[model samples]
Target: MDEADWLAARFEEQRPHLRAVAYRMLGSQAEADDAVQNSWLRLSGADTADVDNLAGWLTTVVARECLKMLRTRRSRREEPIGDTTAEPSAGDHDVNDPEAEALLADSVGPALMVVLDNLAPAERIAFVLHDIFAVPFDEIAAILERSPAATRQLASRARRRVQGATPPRQVDITRQRQVVQAFLTALREGDFDGLLAVLDPDVLLRDGSAELTPGAAGLLRGARAVGAHALAFSRAARFVQPALVNGAVGLAIVPRGRLIGALGLTFRHDKIVVIEMIADPERLRHVGLAAVGP
Candidate 1:
């Protein structure tokens, strides 16, 4: 084989590893593929005759690409508040391949991805590289162009949020997870009665999204009203999943595998009594998120 063919084969060998890194960094399968492809483009044009660690080189390239994409996404974000449009509207990569998507989901659970989505670009890169992949701090520091100590601090901060430093509310966490899971299942199945079943008779739904009107107009009372309202946008339930929101069980709306909103529900007598819809980007940034299960 020629030099180009030999290099192509080597790159193909590292494709999965590179894609996995990108996925954890970007939290979007489509973007991960793009980052990997971009890395390949760079690799194909570079001279690697003296390179002793091709895999490491490729990982760094893809990570940098992912970091760039993340920064761009943050700066250009313009989605409407409380946006619950759930559909697999991503570009052509592995969209039609459910098995591929499922594999990706298993590698990085929905809950963790939601938390990763809220992390700062540098912090996400640092944490994913150092913590998840076991990359060295010096190497990650090179990627972020910061000192190793600074990079370590970034990873530490991200770790605290991902692991949830604050204790959950004074309630039965196991029961709350079950209740939240049931509510999500009901919402996804479009079972109005199921929604009402888990919601208290006098449940109060408050809209903290910027899209809602102020004062009493943002509040909806009664199980019927809340259930009906949830069903109105039940399509979002398809992407919503149970997650640890602010140290307790809650729902995160991750349409197209990207977290955009979260539902903070308060329970009473094992029934949901208050539902808080938080969609403002700033508010979401401050909300602590952790994985609900292993």
Candidate 2:
């Protein structure tokens, strides 16, 4: 076969892995696709005579492209507006689906991804490549432009943070739905005490457009706060529908049935600890709900 045919075969074999790596690094499917396409373009034009490990070379190229995209993305800035308080319109109901919910409810389980978000870009890249994908430190060092020891140190720090962190406890979908229903009921009825019964003692409440309130000084510590936060939102929210978020049971709140906001819940020991509410439009697009079915 000619070099062109040989290269095409090689690219096909490595495409899936390359896409996976890019997706994890960039945290956006669209961006990952772009990075992978760029890698293929570069490979198709390069001299293949001296290429020893095609797979490794392709991965390196993709990683470098992802890093470049990150740099370019960082250079652009846009002001953020926090106006998620408005009620959702009728379009919100159209995005609900049983099948999509089931799929997302199963595949997007929380683990390293959550903790990875907290790390700096370089640290995250180092940890993901070395720990998650088992890429060699030498390759990671080359990608990050740091010494191998430094890359090791970065991975070490990231590992410590992940190890020390608490894993989210699992919550059954039926029970979660019940909790949301009860919380909403109390809110509609103007019964704060009823709402308090359904929440964990260390519950967290966050408005989609505002910064989250820490656990130190909040209403209804634990369960009580959980109930109170639900109540607060229910009072103004037009509809609270349960949906799957990153493979977890979550709620999408719509005021007047429009697509306004969503909340991702992480349960630990049957208590909700991580409640991530996305009211930012840019972040919402990543949640994959814009095209969901009714």
Candidate 3:
């Protein structure tokens, strides 16, 4: 194969990684694709015969483009942080864009992406490179034009900001049934703080009910985010009754004794970690509903 073909192949391999980095940096599908495309354009024109680290080179290129986009948005006062944009679809790349795929298995959650969007451009780049991509701080220092110590500070600040936005680092599912019960009670009462207290720090709540939108959204994470969601839909909790799901404690959506939905929760150290809320009537028939007296 010729040098051009080899180069194209090499870039394709790195596209997924590049896309993941861009998504975390920009938090917009269209913007991330633009950054990745710009990076390829730059790569095609650059003299890379002597370049040793192609991945690092492309990463640096993409980071610069994302940084420019962030700064421009900030200057124009067009801050689009945490709006209702649909989350990035992991492992799904634009056929033409090629670099829009997210990191597999470990794609950034909707809650975390909201936090990253709030960070400054340089802080976001430093954090993504060093913390997310595992790029060395010394190398990131060069990218951000800061000393190693300052670079570390940027990542540190960004890390702290993210921590504040995310759930607690540990999971406690020992009394998961009790936790789920309390969660339901809290939801019924519209006690947002009480509900958050029982959710895993990074709880993933996926609602695939026939009554609502028909897709798995990357939204609903952390206690606060999940709590807000639960509170918003608290009216539904009033009709939920305890049930046996796969021999574990679960919730059945019963309004006036008519079964409609099933919520089987996964716990970690007394916390609700993963909430599987299924509202499809056909699927509900398989949940083995049994009532618990209030």
Q: Quote each prediction's TM-score.
A: 0.50, 0.50, 0.52
lDDT digits (tens) for residues 41-74 of candidate 3: 9998889999999999999999889989999998
The lDDT, on a scale of 0 to 1, for candidate 1 is 0.74
lDDT of 1 by residue, 167-279 (tens): 22345668988898888888888999999889999887878553333466678888998899889787767888888775457889888888899887666678988787878
Ranking by TM-score: 3, 1, 2
Residue 176 local lDDT, model 2 = 58
- Which regions in candidate 1 have their CA more than 4 angstroms from the true location? 78-107, 165-294
Error of 1 at 12 (Å): 0.6
Which sections of candidate 3 miss by over 4 Å? 81-87, 92-102, 105-107, 166-294
Better by lDDT, candidate 3 or 1? 1
Local distance difference test, candidate 3: 0.71
- Using lDDT as the yardstick, the better of models 2 and 3 is 3
TM-score of 1: 0.50
Q: Alpha-carbon error at 193 in model 1, in Å?
A: 19
- Considering lDDT, where higher is better, how would the candidates rank from best to worst? 1, 3, 2
lDDT values, one for every candidate: 0.74, 0.63, 0.71
Model 1, residue 46: C-alpha shift (Å):
0.5
lDDT preference between candidates 1 and 2, better one: 1
